[model samples]
Target: MDYLEYDDYTPGNETENINITTEVTFRGSKSSLSHVLVAFNIIILVVGLGGNSLVIWICGWKMKRTVTTTWYTSLAISDFLFCAFLPLEVFYMITSHWPFGLFLCKLTSSALFLNMYSNVFLLVLISADRCVMIYFPVWSHNHRTVRKALGGIALVWFLSALLTLPSLIFRQTTAHGLVTQCFTSYAGHSTHKAVVVTRFVCGFLIPFLVIVFCSSTLCVKLRRLTIKSSKPYKVMAALILSFFFCWVPYHSFVLLESDVKNHSLDLLQTGLKVGATLAAANSFVSPILYVFIGNDFKQVLKRSLTSRMEEAMAEDLRTIGLSRSKSKSVEMI
Candidate 1:
C-alpha cells in the first residue's frame, strides 16, 4: 500500500519534489477519502467476520467431515482469521498511523498475505476436486476422502506460511513527522523486484491457470452429461471469476510498482490503494457468495440462525453418508 516516491518528480526543483512527496503521504491523514476507505473496511470487517465465523462453525463443528466440507472449513478459517485482524488495519487507515507495535504490524501484514495465498490455493484444490469428480467420476467416487483433503489443506497452509515469510521479515514501521506507517522495506531494488515477481507468479498467475483449466474442463464435462443439476458448475465458475476480478488488479498494481519509474507514481499509488481495498473486500464477499450459492437460500432465510446452522449440519451429515455409500458401491463394483 505504500507507493509514494520522493525521487519520481516531474522535472522540478528539489524543494518541489520534497513537497509533492510530503503531500502524497500526508494526504491520507487529512483527506475525506481516507474516512470513506475506513468506513468501507469497517463494513467488510463486520460482515466478513460474521459470515466466515458461521461457516467455520457449521463446517468444522457441526458437519460430518468430508472432502468438500474440509475444503469449506479451511476456506472459512482463512477468511475468518483475516477478518479478525481487520480492526487493526481499519484503525491504521482511519488514524493514518501505525499505533500497533512493529511486531503486530508484521504479524498482521503476514497474516493477510498468508490468507490470500491459502485462499487461492484452496479454491484451486476445490476446483480440481470437482473437475476430477466430473471428468473421472468413477475414480473420484472411489478415491476422494476426507483424509486426503486434510493433507492437501495442510500442504496449502505450509506453503502459504512459507510464501508469507518475506512479508513478516520485511515489514517495518517508520515515522514521518507525526505520522507512522507500516510497510515492506526491501533491502534493495532487486529484492523488491524479486518479491513482486514471486508474488505475481505464485500468488496469482499459476493458481489462476489451474482454476481456469479445472473450471473449463469441468464445465465441458458437465455439459456432455445429461445431468439436470448445473448449479454447482455455475457456482464454481462464479467463484473463479470473482477471485480473478478481485485479485488481478492488486497483482497488476504490484507488478506496476516494481517499475514505477516507467509509470506515473501518483496514479500507480492510487491504483494500488483501490486494488488493495478491493482485494481485501474479497475475503468477506467469498463467504457470503458461497453460502448463498451453495446452500438453500430460502431455507436459510426462513430458519432462525441457530436452527439454520443445525439444518446445515444435518444436511452435511446426510451428504457425507450418501457419499460414503456411493464410495462403497463403487469399491464393490
Candidate 2:
C-alpha cells in the first residue's frame, strides 16, 4: 500500500488538518531479517496447510452436520484457502519480485484479508451462538440447526468477499526497473486512510468488542450453571487470545503505517513484514489450539483421530445440552 506524506511541516507543532501526498519510495535491499521472515512464513504455510486440512476433513465429513461443526468447518476452509495461497506470497518475498502477473497478485493479497474478515466473523458467530445457548437454551436448542448456521456462514463469506474487493482493485504489479513489484496504489490519501481505518474497525474492532462481550457473559453464566466441561471455555479463550496476539501487531503496524512520514519508513516496513508473518501464523496455530485443548495426549493416542476431533467439537454441544436440561428441571421446582 502507498504511504502518505503531509505537506505542512512545522517542527513541534500540531496541525488539525493538512494536505497529504501518496508518494512512496520503495525499499529494495533485503536484509537478513527478510530471510528470517521468509523462513517463518514457509513454516506457517506448511503447518497451516496440513493442520487446517485435517480440521476440514474432520469437521466437514467425519462428524455429523451440526451447528458447531458447520461453523468449525467453514473456519477451517477459510484458513485452508489462506494457507493454499501462501506460496505465491512466500515466492514474492523470497525473490522480491512478482512474476505471477496482476490477477494472481490481487488474488493472493485479497485472500489474506478474506481470511482475516471471515475468521473474525466466524468467531463472532461462535461466541454469539454460545451466549444464546447459555442464556436462552430452549430457544437455541430448538432453532439452532445446521442449515441456519450454514446460512450465517454464507453471509459472512459474502461480506468478506465484498470487503476484499478493495485489495483486488488497488493491488497491481508495477515494473520497477528489473523487478515487478506487487503493491497497493490508492487513488488518493483519503482513499488510503479510508481503507486502513475501515479494515481496523470492521475486521478487528467490532468483532473484538462483540466477542469479548459474549465471552464474558458466557463465563459468568457458565460459572453459576450446572455445566461440567471447561474444555469449551478453554477452547474459546485460546481462540480469542490467539487471534488477539496474532493480528493486533499487524493492525497496530498498519495504523502506524498511515503516518508513515513521522516514523522511519524502513522500521515501519520491517515491523509490518514481521507483524504480517505473525498474523499468518494464526492459521496453523488455531488447529494446534483446538487439538491440544480438546483432550489429553493419552486419550488422543488411545482413540482414533477422527473420534478425538469429534469429541472435541461435541464438548460444547454436550455442555449446552446439559445446561438446557438443567435449566428446564429448575423451572419445574
Candidate 3:
C-alpha cells in the first residue's frame, strides 16, 4: 500500500537532492487523483468500520465461541483496526503532506501491510480448515476445538507482525520545502528489491497457492462425495475469488515496481494507486459477502442481525451427514 513518495535521502547528496523537486512536482500534479483516492478511502472507512464493528459484536460477543466464530471475529478485528486508521491516510492524501510525526508515519504504513498479511493468512487458514472438515468430518468434529483455532490465530498475528517490520523500519518523514513528506528509505536498491520480492512471496504468492489448493481440493471432495449442501464451500470460494481479484493487481504493480527502470513510472504509480484502493475495498466488501450474500434480505430484515449473522456463519453440515456421528464411515473411508 506504499505510495509513490518522496524519500528522506541522505543529506548533501546533490543528485538525490535535486530529484526531490521532481518527485514533489510529480505528486503535486496528481493532486486531483489523490482527492479521488481520499474520497474512496473515506467511503471505505465508514463502511468498513460499521460492517466490521457489527461483525465483531456478533461473532465476538453475542454468539457462543466456536471455531468458526473465532476465525470470523479475528478477521473482523483485523479489518476494524485497519479501517480505524484510514483517517490518517485520508488526511495525508488530501493535503499531500505529513503533518503527523515520524512515529505515526511508520505506524500507519505498517498498519496497512499488517492488515494485508493478516487478512490473507486468515483466508488461507479458513480454506484449509474447511477442506479438512469436509474431507474428514468425524475427525474434524472431534478435533477442531476453539482452543486450537485460537492458537492458530495467535500464530497468524505473530507472523504478520514479523513480516510488517520492513514498513516500520524503512518508513521515514522529512521536510521537503514547505511540505513534510512521509516515505520509505531503503538502504539501497538491492534492499528495496529484496523487500518488495519478499512481500510478494510471503504476503501474496504463498497464500494464493495454499488457498487455491484448499479450495480446489474442497471442490473435488464435494463432487466425489455428492454432498448437496455447499454453503461453506460457497462462502469460502467467494472469499478466495474476492481476495484474488482485489489483491493480484496490487502485487503485480509491486513486483513491477522493483524493476522501475524497465517500467513506466507513471504506469507503476497509477497502478499502485488504483490497486491499493481496490485492496482496501476488500475490507468492507468482505462483510457484505460474509453477512448478507447467503441470507434472504427480507428475512434478515425481519430477524435480528445476530440471528442473520449466526445463520450466515452456520454451516449446513447436516445435509452432508457431517453433523452426525460417522465413525464407521470414517473407518470405511
lDDT tens digits, residue span 230-312, model 1: 65666667767777888888888878867656767767766777777778788887667766686543244335476878999
CA-lDDT, candidates in order: 0.76, 0.78, 0.77
Lowest-scoring 10 consecutive residues by lDDT in candidate 3?
17-26
Q: How many residue pairs clash in each candidate?
A: 0, 0, 0
Residue pairs in steric clash, candidate 2? none
Q: Which ten residues in a row have the lowest lDDT in candidate 2?
A: 17-26
lDDT score, candidate 2: 0.78
lDDT of 2 at 168: 89
Off by over 4 Å in 1: 1-27, 175-179, 296-333
- Residue 322's lDDT within candidate 3 is 68
Clashing pairs in 3: none
Q: Please, what are the lDDT tens digits per residue for candidate 3 over residues 187-265? A: 6667777888998899999899988888888877777787655665676688778878988898898888666656666
Question: Which is the better candidate, 1 or 2, if ranked by lDDT?
Answer: 2
